[model samples]
Target: MARNSADRLLRQFLLKAIGPIRRLGIPIPAKISKHLQFRGVVDVSVGSGASFKMQSHGHAIENRMYWYGKRGHEPETFLPWLEASKTAEVVLDIGANTGLYSLGAAATNRTSRVLAFEPVPRVAELTRHNARLNPSSNIEVFELAVSDENGTAILHDPGGDQPASASLRGDFLDCKQTEIKVRCVRIDDFLSEVNLSRVDLIKLDVEGIEELALRGMRTTLQTHMPTLFIEVLDARPELMAELNGLLNMGYQVGDLCSDGVIPYDLSDKKGVERNLLFAKDLSRFQ
Candidate 1:
């Protein structure tokens, strides 16, 4: 696997170069990342005995290849969840997009239920396809966006880099592009409909509209208070509401990096590094 995906200088360089652009609200990186081919359907090992099937032209494939070439991706977030997944009842992936975190959870523990939500029709299909590749894993792919409302909304497609980076929030992508209407639902409402009693872990990465999505999941957040791996793009006042809300729900938040999940401050955003892990009991995370 490493021989096929390792040291593709151009591909890795492109992904690295576009990192800043992506953080600046540009979608060009996502577009290029999707079309640039490093290899075809290479396997990615995410550590802790977990692996995933990734693609050459898929969204974030270059990054996945880098992990294959080096070590696993986001050990600060991935490793801890993997340790806990064996006993977790349910793992929710909001914006799964080809099953990065979702596939990792399922691969780590076949008994745990990994529910992946990707609103883009094609991306959702791709996620399901990835899940199928891991026959022993237990994962369910849903083709709907989770927001603060139950209805339909315009999902702006990046049109090249990948469908995984598509967004429901307007002006998400700096450049002009096309869009498709997608069904949206709040997690709280869907949980009730499905009668899910508990959710052990959640990975939320929906561009920058995460605050709105959390608003709709207030009940679920209060009930489960599941450990959350969320990415916040900006430190804007609006986005802070979401983090503050979690605090009000008796949860603590921190940045998830290679070292660990450390105390996170909104003013300390370094770049596109926005993944924050929230927990009611920090000791569980430690």
Candidate 2:
């Protein structure tokens, strides 16, 4: 009874907060708004205050919705690599949010297979939904968080349309306070279990847990030497270590923007931290 009451209270608070944003009719990019509309996910209003109805995917698809609209577009930095790779047979999307990379890769013909991993249940659900909507025969969705160890952990619900880092405190504004036993697996174990010989590309954007995931994939790194496109945020020291670890492994790195690749070295760890890239071999691109 108490749990039900708490849930109701949380719902009310979230609705109250979301209602204002919904009414404001924020301006979203055309492509993003269109995608959302086609999927019947977003009900947006343009400059004229006219109500625009997005195509409904069906009875209000949940867990597969993309929050923040076009902001969810593939980070400009990774586009070139994504386009340049013609022989990429296997793609691994770590922290595959709402199937952006997952759906995009599945849409492309070059990518023969894709494995999307999202630990957050809500986001994972959306990933699965988008994958199904797109219907990629080769895409596989895994609803588990990847780390160095294999076990269950607490997934904090910072409730919104999308899932954020699982927090330790139960203080999300509109999020229901609940504990989900999410699976934690390493890349080596994952590869062994699935018997994957090679991975062409690995794109990771797992909040602040990238290091742990990388640590778990040391074996995969040594074996496949797949090109990695990681979203390296500058806020965490642990993340910095992960990037350094990759560099230590002798991978050449660069930034992927809409224009082209900008090669860089992370030898200096003291500048105003920016999103950078690393590659195992620059000659491959040349």
Candidate 3:
């Protein structure tokens, strides 16, 4: 018990000292900065007229954005996302971690509608808070998970400090025993319920349940044929199934590059690329 208290005190001291260290311009190593956890919200600008609000709590995505803007977080994905957002009338940000993509998309096109889905309660609230921080942007925060079916699912969260890693699958990421039951919905049904007829682009990164969510939106995929920006960590069975599903629907796959997207051969089992673009028409990205 005494050891636990000592450790708690040490952590509190360290968290308090980070601010003064930053004020002194002391260089904090990436490894150390990653583990530094605290609670606070701040508005960040990525230059131009693009900007968003982010809450800091050791989340890699928000921290990177705070330090290096969208480029540092996921330039390959974010750059294309922002470009697509400029003209997209409707965007769905599945697994919207703290409104990074949602707010940015809304900022790029204030008239466009951005629907952000986050299952974790606290994380969803954080997204809402970030949206509120940007009053000019049109972003809707939904505290629900998108899946193949409409029901409730156990969302596994590693911890409060690792909100970005939360997922529907219990085994996904380094999920701890901590879990929460969150409402789930099929994309098709949800959109129909909301009376949204068009979806210009979709940013899907739902940890390991990507396939299930895709399955739920099969109708939308066929009808809307929206441009898709997805994180493909590797060729898992679930991911491959959905990739094949899209490919069979006449969607071409490409790897997001600094210049633009290039055709990607799915046969390469090595899984070198972490992100991919699936679209019926690749010219939109060019």
Write the residue-wise lDDT of candidate 1 on 109-225 in tens digits: 777888999988877877887788778888899988889999999998887635556888778878776789999999999988888888888888898788888888888889888
Best-fitting candidate, measured by TM-score?
Answer: 3
TM-score of 2: 0.68
Mind sharing the TM-score for model 3? 0.82
Candidate 3 clashes between residue pairs 3 or more apart in a chain or in different chains: none
lDDT for each candidate structure:
0.74, 0.61, 0.81
- Which window of ten consecutive residues has the lowest lDDT sum in model 2? 44-53
**What is the alpha-carbon lDDT for the whole of candidate 2?**
0.61
Candidates ranked by TM-score: 3, 1, 2
| Tens digit per residue, CA lDDT, model 3, 1-286 | 9998886687668767776776465666767666654546756555476777777765677666544556656787788788888889999999997778898788888799999999888778888888888888889999999999999889888876446778787777753567789899999999999999999999998988888999999999999889898877678877787888899989989888776788888877865447889887777777
In terms of lDDT, which candidate is stronger, 1 or 2?
Answer: 1
Pairs that collide in candidate 1 are 30-161, 31-160, 31-161, 34-161
Considering TM-score, which of the candidate structures 1 and 3 is the better prediction for this target?
3
